[model samples]
Target: MKNLILLLVTLLFIAGCTSNKTEFKISNNGVEAQVLQLKNHQISYTVKKDGHVIIDTSLIGIVVNEKSLGSNSKIRLSERFSEEFDYSMFGGKNTAYHKTNISKFEIKEKDGFTWFLEFLVSAEGVAYRYIVPGTGTQDVKGELSSFRFPNNTKVWYFERNNDWKLKSHAGEWLCSDISQMPAISKMGPVQGLTLTCEMPAGGYALVAEAALYNYSGMRLEAIGDNTFKANFAEGEKGFEIEGDILTPWRCILLADDLNSLVNNTLVPSLNPKPDGRLFADMSWIKPGKAAWYWWSGKFSTFEAEKRTVDNAEKLGFEYTMVDEGWERWSNKWETITELCNYAKNKNVGIFLWKHSNQLNFPENGYALMAGFLDSLKQTGAVGVKVDFMNGETKSLIDFDEALLKLAAERKLMVNFHGCQQSSGEYRTYPNEVSREGIRGVELNNMKEGPLSASHNAALPFTRYVTGHADYTPLAFTAPGETTWAHQLATLVCYYSPFQCIAENPEYLLKTQKIQPAINFINEVPSVWDETFVLPQSKIGELAILARRKGNDWYLGVLSAGEKKQLQVNCNFLKEGNYSAEIFSDDILAEPVPLEGLNPRANLTKRNTAIPFKKEVIICDKNNNLMLNIAANGGAVIWFKAREK
Candidate 1:
């Protein structure tokens, strides 16, 4: 009887051990994540950094046909492969990009079907996606994709608006202790949020959707317990999985510091590589500045618009963007063609704008979108800015994809305005040179008044981490609430390959007081080979960056705080002599009245926006220089390699 009882106990122990099955792991750049098979045969994962658990086991599954397809899933087969690749960029934070390992687990459901869960371990972070096989069309009811944070984890996110048409993607970023993350909105579902976490154990992680093609844009809904579930927009829960589909990647961008976070390549790396063959001469898809007319809010005629193009020539700007209302001009088509020809003579390109709704088919009888793109190309205009596409439903994503392919064939560059947050799809379509996803300079003129000083300082650590934005950095805002030096620094702070500056020629070119910084602005390029975030930088307080272009390094320092002396270290430079040109505020120089300024700016009471002092200093890589920056002001320092 005793032997029989012992045997029964041993048998029960064996069964329990089997239920706690082994897990698979993939690691890169000091970050590791474990995929666990739970007792219920469902899939779950835990993330670790430096062998410390940052994210405890979290659920990972999908609901299909109104049922939980993964509830009874068993890992039937597992495979792992690692590879590395490199490519050059036409325009990006990095001139060259590298991507590196992927693991695949085949989960067999109770229905005798197998689907895949794929993970790509990257240097900056980890990304995972679902691949549903044998699919004619699978009614994907919902997903169990969720992120569970460790105790005391913090996150910075924009409280997303339910009405996406109101430029929902653009908003001032806010931070919260995940434990106390607010439940916002009338429905109180915590909808439209994307969590970018500041891990408790150090380092950072931004939860974002990547390579989103043919999939509905996602938002994270707070479900309590310091967790957020991946969910679709309202009425977009039914995800149609047509054919063998690779669902968009749910990515976590990890970094150890502000510099690493700003330099994370997780987003674009998940996207398919660009097909260089799209254009006969890819050089035409270059990176440079543009003269934009609409920001002035002045009644611009054909002659005024043409003068903007002429300013492009004078300023060495590669393009001149003509915003809305251009179509209302008499003989619109022919008149635009004439303007295009005029710009082409001066070696400047023209970019025309059109409301995204007008570009759609059927009702507009535009019949063929290709015809419109072709006409623009014939007129010698180099690009088009598609605006007001404020939503990201499946059909709209398809429209964006189709439009990019069409524009590529016609050799016309494209900029998506008032759009959704970038999923790094630009890697697949380089023609998409710029996009507006952040609450940029336009907000600086809203009835609410200029974007807060903190908002500008904090952007690099938040929004710009995913991709560059068409902030249209305004040099014209000096003398108002922000210093001219601060406005000038944005050229380095915000990057848009098709960099459109929100100012007419006079303010930028002929303004006497602004000339000191204008010359350097003209010389600055819109792309960078390397970037370094200085130690003094703080979120919503100060921003100091050193970005390299060829042999020169541009240092931009923006302060949202009071006047104080700050030091700069040229540690990023090589061990050799260098020339540093410093441009900072001249506080005593009189203020000017606001013109060409939107009423939202409300600078009824303003200061001298253009007064600046320029000084040159000789330095080496080891030198530390002090700068006296004013409240709501900034400075720019250019380091040229004298040794080289």
Candidate 2:
């Protein structure tokens, strides 16, 4: 009896050990993920938590292509293989976060490539790992985290650096480092979390995010083994029945280049500006002229339209943009034709606004869309501002490319609104002139003072680093707009080849307070030969940028919320006597000695530091002159140097 009992105990112990062992592996495509019993690879277990089956690996990574469905929903799970690792962090206490045991690992394909590999932990946080083979360079580096929120939720969140802040408007968005969050909105109760980053050459890793969703009563709980899987309700039976409960998900794309980024996001094609085409033939469009538009407001009445166009030309603007609300009948032909003729008679080019779908005629059949493009050409419209294509899906991307092609064919300049951040598209599509991606002058009209200023400063290093942004600079406030100084500095702060100074042209011509900046903007070309972000040490407190437009180089320095000083260097300039025009806030009321202004001073030997909150100093760079800028303000300096 004793021997039999001992044998029974041993058998039970063996069974417990076998049950506790778990095995996880990558699917054949390198993206579909499967969990198997340790002893037998064929014996697979579906993703489950607390005894509830979540997703089956068999159905997780299926690829579906459709126009009606947005790009955010498509899932592709493929293997990512990398040989090296490159990682860096900013604003956090620890900068270098590397992984052990992950010198190499396989990225399992589980419902939409939403799987995480637990790697080494650091003081900063845990580093989740994924591998993308043959799709990366010698080394791989990408952003570490992304944030997701439910629809209709509003929150104020700050990053580690605190240089940027977030005030979201009823949609999903992502923030990196200590930067302000871009406001995003889409039609539908569902909100999405989207992030795009360039991987290092020849190496790739899994992109991961730690998410927190605020629901009324339920406590925050771990829904699945992997955060990516838990956040996304893939193959869940009862998810649709749960009304009003916001389901938040995380998505990461394994991309080899910018093209892959576009392709993975399901954007069919990109609008690329042709190289040096504008330089060859911009005389017809009148380059270096001021422009204005009445946007997001009433401009339908014939009398109102006539007055606005007349006022725009009279105020020294060479062009007028008639934004939305004009397409009341969905027929753009008659309205655009009339507006273009009216603006042409007034000697101002008319920029008409239309939605991308309407302009491209996506739903009306392809041939009919072609006819509409032909009509736009006949209407004599100088340009068209297409808006509301915020998706990165293939159809939307293809539509963007088609619109650019149509515009080019018709000789019409284009401005893209509600766009993802610029990705050097202007390089190929010169006619695709400007894009509204930054938090610019519009925020001043919607929100209060200086928030726009703070966000604008943060953009140069982040969004503008990618390419030109049509920030719609220079709004002169009679009572409630941007400060006069802020308006003056925007020309230098925001970098766009096609800069739109949106305001009542009459107001600008009469006040003439913003002329200096306007003149500077006109003289400067949209394309830059080279660019650099000045090192200020502090993040949001101040930012300095320098860009070259020919033999002449323009440098702009801006401060946000606080007074800061920067040391200027003239090493970037070829040795020569060049004039530097400095613009700043009134320094007289607040006395502070400006530093690093001397690259080279002249017989004008102006130690002359003007004491105004906002001031412009024109100095010759023959003698080193240090530029002193004020808080909540900026300085624009132009220097002409000999070619190296």
Candidate 3:
């Protein structure tokens, strides 16, 4: 009887061991994630950087039509593959993105309905999505994705507002406790589109949605305790898939610093490649500077609009953006057609604005929009800016996709103003060059003192991390609020493909103090060949970004705090001598009127917006350079490699 009892105990112990199961791991470039499939189909994963825990067993799964995917998922045919590919960009950091290391896992589920979950692991981060093979339709009840971080993690929270007009105050990124999730609201207090976490190990991890096609945009719900759940704008059972559907990529970008975070191309790399045929000779899709008119007030007459276009030509701007109210001119069609022709003769293009909701209005809206775009094409209008797309619902997402596809068909470049953050769509449609998702210069117009230097300093590390921001930069403000040099530096600091020079043309030519900066701005390429973020930079305090367009390097340094000195390391430059032009705050210049002076003046002009000092420096194999930036001020440096 004793021998039989011992045998029974041994069998029970074996059963317990089988139930616990061993963990599965996927890793690349010293980053690792261990995944476990728990009881009731729950999927949990913990991310490790260099074998140190960063993400602690985060829950991730989905629910379909009120049924949980975690209820009973049987993994079938698990396979892994890695591929390396390269791509060139018309407008982005570097002309070409080097090889991408894609490690993918394809798993089949088996709990009645047939579906697949594919997880892509890369050196930069992780992304996963669901695929329904040959589907009729699937009603998604909701997603069960949650991010649980270590208690020490902190975040830069952006309280989102569903209403488009309320987006201005959302620009400021406030550092906050990870455990405190803001209350959910359709109006305010929502988390940012990208929730960046400061890791305990001195690294960074960013969470955002990618390839957001046919799905509602994803937001994060802080459920407390260093935990956040993926929340879609769509309610339970709101998302439906039809005919071989693939879901959007839910991604997390991991990096060692703010620079690496800014430099990571993981989001676009995860998107579908742009079909060359869709663009049909993308050579005409020019990415350059535009002179915008709305900020200076409505140019309701052809003559008023003509002066703006003339200023654009004077400043060598490639385009003049004719905003709303242009339709009020007598003989509107003739006036616009004449303006386009005039701009073309002056070697400048035109971008027109249209209200997004107007296109959605009843019977005539869609037809009218289509017809207007066709007319614009005939009128030689190069681009269109669609504004006021207030929400991130599925319907709006669908509408945006449709509009972009149509715009591509018409061979017109597009800019989405007052819209949601970009979801890597530019990878698939090259014509969609820029979008306004941040609270930019337009906010400064509403409240004079709010979009301060600190807000500008934080933008690169925050908003620009997600994608290009149409901040409509270079607006003038009170002398005590932001220095003239800071405004001038922004044109180089911010990355916008269809960059808008927010100042009036008259200001660019008349601002005598900023002309030297203006000359550099005129030639500054909208896209970059390379980018470097200085190590000494701090979020919300200072930012120093250096970018290369061909052999020329543009350095933009901004300080939101007290005056301080910083260094620019040019070790990344080719081993050779170069001539550098420095535009910085004039320590001795007389102060001008701090009020009523147009803030949107062409800053590169001397005495244009704020008085500045310009100097020429020569580098003799010493790449290290230093400068003193004033409080609420900044600097712009142009380095050109000398001919051998």
Candidate 4:
């Protein structure tokens, strides 16, 4: 009888423990997150695709003023909501992208400090944020958000190249298996905006952030065995959080295939809709190619810029950037107006540049910027490229947003340079088309700063995972560092709404040797309706991208290490006849190879331009074509579907 009583007691104890924990399931499009909310205890979660776990039990919480948020907290309330984004980002990838997601959880913690730990799960991935409500102010001492992967997970990431360490969120793409993973403290800070993980559970995930506002930028730091914790920028001190605080949405972009990973719109979907009342006339914003003199080793002058506008018109480009040196022109504003007028006749828009610091003075910053922007708009300029804002403190973020709003007020587009990673800012403010958080092509001006073929190959998978980077691609100033064909391929592979081409006027418009490449550049569209990362692509080795604008499909294949044959198939096309225009490295006109002695240098210096060849062919849905690419070379194929 005594034994039976004891057994009943034991069973009740087990029941009590189970009842204390509640599992709230939020799922969509095969991606699901099960958040286990412990009553008055620490909270944790597990993310899964179908039934397989992509993220093991991971902790998610934030501490305010040294008080634990998730731990020793009560779930005072919970609710559900749905959101839909039907409008388009005027200057982004898709013309009109539709999104729907379900929201779960809004917990209340100590002293009416009602903070809702909300999660939005969409088909692309999961995004969550902490919405803390209060009256006065709050100090966020720490963020305990972390992603704990399986012991054998492989992470494809990059080291922080700038002084921001990982804060800059820009560098050469890299990958690491178990042996190369650095220790927690020694790893400094790694990329947080977008970091890819080859899950041990048979899928892929990209860790990133979205909708950043009034907060310091985030960088991930190795915290444990195959785990990374969210670390805020170190210099972001005393950032006052007043009223209701909405933290940035931490995003997990998931996919079963490389194509899905590359095309997921979770990052942008998390951002709030653009202010309809502010930007009622979205037609003013346009996305197209541009010609710039920066990478041409030439400075812009009044007459010189007119010549560039002519080059832009000749190449069928929609815009030309006067760049930094135009201010040095005597009677700068008048010269700018004259250049803008000249370009206006040829239907080419003009872009101007400004030092970010000049717009930061508290005394007359707003007045100066407003006056200048108004005057510049009067001069027929279309946009401004604000440069040298290399930090991510909350103050800097505030200024950046202010600039975008100011620029937008005058119907001007803004491109930020020396900036932090694009945390889906373009989604909210589409007028800010692109940013140079990336180490772009202009670095070739340095004797030792030329980019390698492998680095360019890795770009689409790594750096571009965030958003449009103003890489200013297809520069021929440092020829033979990569084949001109390779440079041409970048114009297609890279994503920039501004699509700024930095090739000099002479070679791009006059030289017949590279006319095929130039023609290919002029034909491809800047944005696409569809993008497919071909199965042949291997990160850091090769990039095979198939993109479609209207009914025409363009396939760009870039080879990194050595001379090799890359094939293209018509499977990506619909069932119909298509005429394909192929531009490739000229087999009969390869660069003259010289005996190389320097072991450190990757490519031998060449003084002459590398030649290319173009071919026209008819293909069907089942056709396959194989073409040889020289070392550090590439090819482009534009397939136009025939009329029925």
TM-score of 4: 0.90
TM-score of each: 0.91, 0.55, 0.90, 0.90
Could you tell me how far off, in angstroms, the CA of residue 135 lies in candidate 3 after the best superposition?
3.9
Model 3 over residues 1-644: C-alpha lDDT tens digits? 43234224323322232232335677778777766665544455667877767776666566655555543564543666676676776444854352433333333356466666666667777777777555577676556666777877878755434344233224456566675554434453346477778887788888887898877777776655566666666654367766765778877888887778778787777778887678768876888899877775644467877888898888888988888887677877777889999999999999988888777542443566677789878878899998887767776777788778778888899999878777778878888888887877765555423466777887787778767878887765323367777887888789888998776667667867667777886888888988888888787888888888888888888788788777778776767778999888875677555344654432222232345688998884466788877777898888888998
lDDT of each: 0.75, 0.41, 0.71, 0.73
Candidate 4 local lDDT, 1-644, one digit each (tens): 43234224323322343334767788887878877765535566778898877776666787666565775555633677777655565322475354546555666565655578888787788878887776788777656677767767777776544464453445656677622454422444445556778877767788988988888777675644566666666522435677777899888888887777777777776777788876888787899988887666456667777888898999999998778888788988888998898899999999899888888753555777787789889999999998887777676787788888889989999888878778878878889878887766765554545677887888787778768888888755464456767777887788888888866765677765666556667878887777888888877789988888888888887678888887777798877888998878875685534233122222434544455578899997799998889888888888988988
Clashes per candidate, residues 3 or more apart or on different chains: 5, 58, 19, 0
Best by lDDT: 1
Give candidate 2's error at residue 306 in angstroms. Answer: 5.7
Q: State residue 461's C-alpha deviation in candidate 4, in Å.
A: 2.0
RMSD for all candidates, in order, please: 6.5, 14.9, 7.2, 6.9
Better of 2 and 3 by TM-score: 3
Candidate closer to the true structure by lDDT (higher is better), 1 or 3: 1
Q: How many collisions between residues are there in candidate 4? A: 0
lDDT of 1: 0.75
